[model samples]
Target: MGIRHSSAGKMIWLLALASLIHVSSLEAATAETVKQKPPRLNIVFIFVDDQGYYDLGCYGATEVETPRIDTLAQNGVRFTDYYAAAPICSPSRTGLLTGCYPRRTGNEVWVHRPDSGTGIPPSQTTLAELFKSEGYATACIGKWHLGFSEPYLPANQGFDHYFGILHNLDSYEVAHFEDQGGVPLLRNGEVVDRNVDPGKLIKLYTEEAIGWIEERVASRHETGSSEPFFLYLPHTMLHEPLGVSPKFDGSSNWGLYGDVIQELDFYTGRLVDALERLGIADETLVMYVSDNGRGPGRNQQQPIRGSKLTTFEGGLRVPCIAYGPGIREGHESTVVAHAMDWYPTLASLAGISIPKELVLDGRDLSALLLGETDTIPEFNQKVSLNAEVPLRREFHQDLEWERIFTRQEYLNAFFYHGSHGALAAVRSGKWKLALNPSLTLYDLEKDPGESHPLNSWEIKTKLRGMAIRFQREMIEQGNSN
Candidate 1:
């Protein structure tokens, strides 16, 4: 009987040992999986309204003190030849968000009133939508001029939170010809104030942005979530009818405009400080840019001809600063980049897959921004035209138009000017062909001011032909829509 009891005890001990081994293996596997996951990346996009190409200190403004914006450029990469998608407001924003040319959405003209029926279509995918799909919290905290209707607001357009005016802050004044009375200030689709104070708008925006970041961080900590976030802060300071808070009043050498700019710089510094204090500076990507060129008589645009209304370098070119992880410090890139490129670049950085069916006019700039390669693949290669047939009219709603350039006609660098539905000019590398009543070609490299007109029969003929073809294609695409 004693021998039988001892054997039963030995069998029980063996079963316990096997169970311990199985539990230990399971814990080890979990640890390894956690370590293999990539860290989440955050994005902060700061867009200034009607800021000039040389408005900030780093970009070369002596009167306007912009230390914060200058520091951002010093710490990150600056683009000397960056261009906005359009020369105006609404169209520029549309192109930036959709990653397509403004003409593709039939929004080439500037949108002024809130009652305007035109806006970004619901069928299109926005940058916020792409980021939100990957579990990022998205927010827009300034100047939302895309649309004013419930269906067109930022909340319906993939942003988790929206706060600011539905259109320009100056829309509240009665002097403007297109004034829609007082603009509605909103928070999450609800009207908080009808007539917002322009003097306090910049300060208020900065404070709200800081608060949003803190709240998001605390919530993530409590929930133990590794999800990232996207913040779009579009300031309305430098536009017409500018005003600065009492603290910044008469603080700059350039009067109220300069004072407003200085205030903008300070508040921007506050945001950067917040990021550092919250311990997310290393993981966040901050981009500072302007919607278009500055307002006339309000800012300087030396060496670049024309202003906000024309199809010239001054009208399209704007300051661009990129700072954060994975970006080379204090670098300048002359590779022509547009506002539309941010869509694909940000998505590529976050490891999100773009849909195969979606057509993108912009190329992924991850390689160029990361210093992995100086050359962008296919940047200079001509696009093939015969590979795909023309898109049918039914697909027009989807913006399924033919490629902009054919392989034989493609230039190393090209920019089309579609201001107010008219193709005014075409810039192919250093040559610019303007078709305002007559065809005039100029070499921008030699005459940055565009004072001298060149009479090159060969270059003019080639660019003129390309322009005519482009116009014809645009007309055909419009008819299809």
Candidate 2:
């Protein structure tokens, strides 16, 4: 009887030892997995106004210093061929928020009135809404040009808080409105009693943003649940009738425009530093991009010829920088992308699903950001509108509508023919044809600056066909209807 008892005790001891070993191995594995996982990234979108490709220090700009923006590029991916859906403000901003083409959304022009239905349609879902649904807090500060109505403001468009101008401004130094009807700043929906001073608009935006961040962090700490936040900071910097803060006046070697750019850089530095100080630097994503190109007319002070109205490269290609966790640093992406992409990209970052109805013109660049997209997809794009033909012999000719019959017709005749009425373009591979019943073909690979035209009938016809197909698609997709 004693021998049998001893044998059973020995077996029990062996099983107990195995269980202890298993628990230790499981704990070690759990610790290893936690260490390997990347931190959750918070997003901060810093959008500047009328900034150009050569506007930043990293993009070959020698005129003004953009050291802070440069540091962002050093730590993140810089897009070389990034584009805005439109070459203007209101429309492009609409595209950025909704991830849909502005033309499709019926916001093909700028909105200048408070009652104008020119803002983002209430029916449409914005990035903020999508993020908010998934437990992220969102705020939009500076330049809400969509519409000034209660239903059209930032809060209604998915933002928890909105602060900024109601429309485009000719002078950033003047009052936005004559009375209470057009207060420049608001929280949620009520206008702040202290009107936003035009000269200090940039500083105000930065200060408000920092405040928002601190509030969010505190709220998370109190709730014991950290809900990530999205900060959309769009500044009216480098825009015409330039307004500079008193400290930045005469601070730049380049005049008013230069001074404004310097001011922009300074504020951008402050925003980034605030995040770092709050201990959210590595987890926060900072994206610096321009809404569109500069003015179409020639800059008497600079080398570029064109201002906000022209269809040239100077009026289309803008500056864009994306920086954050897990992103490849200092790498440049040549992928043809637009502002509309931000919607889906931000959605993906927040682990939210984009709406099915919101057809996006731009793709999620996550692969590009993670160093996975080696081969870029061909960008076959076109900008189409009814153009007025110039009288063969006169400059002040009557306006007449000519339906650009085919892409071939448009490209064979109209690229770079920016007269007055309308213009369109078709870019495929290295060939880009900007047309308006006047053919202007450009090999972007060779002439990245669009300084010379190829002037070949074969290339023109091929691109024109591509443009026609694009136009047809646009109409069929209900984008032009």
Best-fitting candidate, scored by TM-score: 1
Backbone clash pairs in model 1 (N, Cα, C under 3 Å; residues 3+ apart or in different chains), count: 1
Tell me the deviation in Å of residue 356 in model 1.
1.5
**Residue lDDT tens for model 2, 1-481:** 0101123332332232222222333244554443433324578999888887677778766668878888888767788777676677777788788776676566766533555755777877887887887778899998887876667878888888887766556644235465554455666666674444556888888999999999988887898777888899888676654688889889766787878888888888888888767766656778999987874323333333344556666766678888765456678787666677677565544445455445555555554564545434112111000011011111111122133243223222222212222336766656778775587888876676667878788777776665555455456666333
lDDT of 1 by residue, 1-481 (tens): 0101123332332232222222333245555443444346688999888888877888878888887888888867898878888887788888888776677676777664566776888878888988998899999999888876776789878899888876775534323323434666778977777666788889888898999999999988999988789999988767777989999999988888889989999988888889878767766778999988863323334577668866777788889988776666678877767887787677765656566555555666665666645644343211111111111111222122234334334323345555575677776667888878788888877776677899997778667666665556567766755
State every prediction's TM-score relative to the real structure. Answer: 0.82, 0.79
Q: Quote model 2's TM-score.
A: 0.79
